[model samples]
Target: MTDAFSSSSETVLQRVLEVSLKSNTPVDKLEELYQIKATCDFILEHQFAKVALQFPDELLGDSVAIAEEINRNTNAKPFILGDTSYGSCCVDEVAAEHVGAECIVHYGSACLSTSKRLPLMYVFERRAVDVDRCASSFRELYPDSRSNVVILYDVSYAHAVKDLVTILSPEYPNLVSSELVVEGERCYSPGFIKRLNNDSLPPEQCDSQVIYQFGRQFSLKSGSSITDYSMFYIGEEGATLRNFMMTWNRCSFCSFSPATMTGRAESISVNRALMKRYYAIERAKDASVVGILVGTLGVADYLTIIQQLKETIRRAGKKSYMFAMGKLNVPKLANFLEIDIYVLIACPENSLLDSNDFYKPVVTPFEMEVACNKQREWSEEYITDFRRLLPGGQSHVPLADQQDESDETDVSLITGVLRSHNLLNGEPAETPSSSSMVLRNQTLTVANTNSAASFLAGRSWRGLEQKLGDTPVVKAVEGRRGIAIAYEEEGTAS
Candidate 1:
């Protein structure tokens, strides 16, 4: 047993050390992959004085070399950013703003969420792909030449997509390839824009012909619905594939992995994910206290959605608290035992948190909306992006009025107990003037009205205690201390 434990410990230590080591790549290949010349041109054209270069953990091995090259070519001062405040996929605008950087150049895999504050650029770091192999795999999986299909790919493999389309388009005329929307470029598809402005068109005619999700956009052929198409993504398995699977659960989905150089059909249970989200919504509806966790500051209109969620919770007669903790973990969230449930307001890619390790259920803004707003109805069309819940978005669901049955009660599905609708009444629960005794588990205890405060009070270790007058005051004395690593008394004790 001891030998096995020691071996595992040594393996973990080696992996930790390996993370700090840098992997070397040739200079010319690095420059071509990162498009150093294009980045230098962008900096020069913008006349930026200070630029922050952000790289995800995997790509950080080459960050120093890339920064030095950019500094040599461009007049702008370049600095490499360390660990990001939130998800690495997001552009760490908050970190860039702290250094007063005029712009940011992000590298590696990105969520491509729109940044609100700073001007940003992305370098996908082009990856190699065998177009012929991918073409052959596509034909095998999709034997029918007239099958309705849409081709989407990871941004790293984007450069080879044009070649793949050229090779496959000749035989398969129904094949469509989606385009990635870059910064400072037109966002909405032509069909989407046309349908939006044409209010006089009938309901069926006004429905969008273009489908947009995350950073990619594609239009369907006239008279064909989105449900009629099958999605084929080219990328390694990760959050991007999961997001695509959940968002378009109705469509048939498959993926091609460039690393393995093989194509395989994905059998992700989209219904299972949606069922879990629905369960979270039901749990939130029964919660008396909701903690609104701010997961991002870079995504556009985050503040607006936070405010909207707060108001919605208020109208539902529930208590809410806002937190801005950098990144969420079990320990950070566990510290707040008072909160019954948590609502995470983050970018679409980072919003869906796996709550298996969390003490309480964590829900997204859309789920919170369905729980608090009586007007909204649950549907299979799940939305992870908080922006879509904002006013004027396609999935926007309005909050219920304050006067709508504020005092009604409903039975909780999980706890089979009647819960009051107006338990908090849009205010913090206050301690009653007189305490009542209750028998719980054969023990008699004084019951307090403020459940949150009572929970903290019951904890044995309730932080540091402040005894104002119980303890006698003592004179100040010099303490033996040096630095944190080594104390002054350590040498004398030795």
Candidate 2:
């Protein structure tokens, strides 16, 4: 019995440390996987002296070896960057700049959002896929050869997309495969550029030939709309799939996991998620104080979005605060109890924060726009990217035409209380005069101010308070000084 128990414990321990049991990858294979040669060429071509190599947590194991290889191949100094200041999917331009890195080479899965300052090179480590199995799974899910299907995939399995398409195109004529383009002139599709340049035409009317969501771009049949087609995703379920689903919520989705070698129809609906976002927007309208949380510094136009959000909040007659703390959690946000709602400006994939774990509700920039902009209206279409909310983007709503709705009085559905929008106009509440004072059950009850500062003032522990001039001052006295581990006074006594 004792021997069996020990053996079982050993098995569990091995399972827990299974990642360590994997054999080290060969140098030659690692070079190919990380595209070390290409990275070195990019650095040398650009004449970058200091190069920053950014890797996600899962890919950190091979970061050192990859960095060394790059260092040996090129004259540029290579520095490994981990614990990214923002989402790992984005290039850590902030951290790269800290070391004065001239360029950033990001490894592992990426969101492909454009970086602001530094040049970025992505090394999506190639992962093996059973092409035959994938083709077979595709056929099973989409049996009709003429089905209007779009093939979206993870960047790691991007190498196999060509072969998969080659095999399926012969039979499936209406198949469309999305390409992940990060940098260079090919970054934005023609349709995307047209939409950005021309705002007079509605998005749907602005060339339905192509569609761009997040960083993935694809073209549809000449006359067919994206809504007319079904989406077929190749990769494990993750942020990529979730973003895809949210963006093209109208299309039916089916995903095939290479790891599991199984294909299934995606039944997860974005309707519930959309409803939650709408609810957050409604809550924002009722908020008197808003917190603008900077969730990313790498994505292009992040600063512009931050400024826009501030201006929008100000125009709404609400108090606004900006925070740039790296990474967000309950404790960090809970510290700012005065913030009625937090508007997270981050990459699309990281924007929709789950509010369940948070003390205060967190919302995306799009939702914030709808809540703050009285001219903006809620619709079936939802935008996750902050860039689209910029001045010229399709979803951009100008604040110039906004009507003054502050004087309107209505009841809050959330609080079920009669609330006045005028309370959020940043005007100080009037103090009751002594002549109008009335007794209420032998206790004084003041009218609710319905403001964040008023809420904080009512809290039991409103942070440390300095009673200036109230407490008597004492003469200073010398105290024993020593290291934290062992004090000098204690050592002398012993």
RMSD in Å for all candidates = 8.8, 10.0
Weakest ten-residue segment in model 2 by summed lDDT: 1-10
> On a 0 to 1 TM-score scale, where does candidate 2 land against the true structure?
0.80
Clashes of each: 0, 0
Candidate 1: which stretches are off by over 4 Å? 1-23, 182-208, 406-408, 422-451, 464-494
Candidate 1 lands at a TM-score of 0.83
Q: What is the TM-score of each candidate against the true structure?
A: 0.83, 0.80
- The per-residue C-alpha lDDT of model 1 at residue 486 equals 75
Q: Could you give candidate 2's per-residue lDDT for residues 1-494 as a string of tens digits?
A: 00011111222111222234232566668866777777777788778898888888888778667766777889677767767877888878877776677888888888888765877777786888899999999999988898999999988888889899999999998888877655453222211121122234346545747677677777776688889999999899988888888878899999889999999999886898788888898799877679999998888899899989987887765678889877788899989877889999989888877888888899989898887776678887888899998989878888754344444455667877655443434334432432222222112222243455556656788888898999899999998789877787778543
Give candidate 2 misplaced runs (Cα > 4 Å).
1-24, 183-208, 402-406, 409-411, 418-494
Model 1, position 292: C-alpha lDDT score: 95
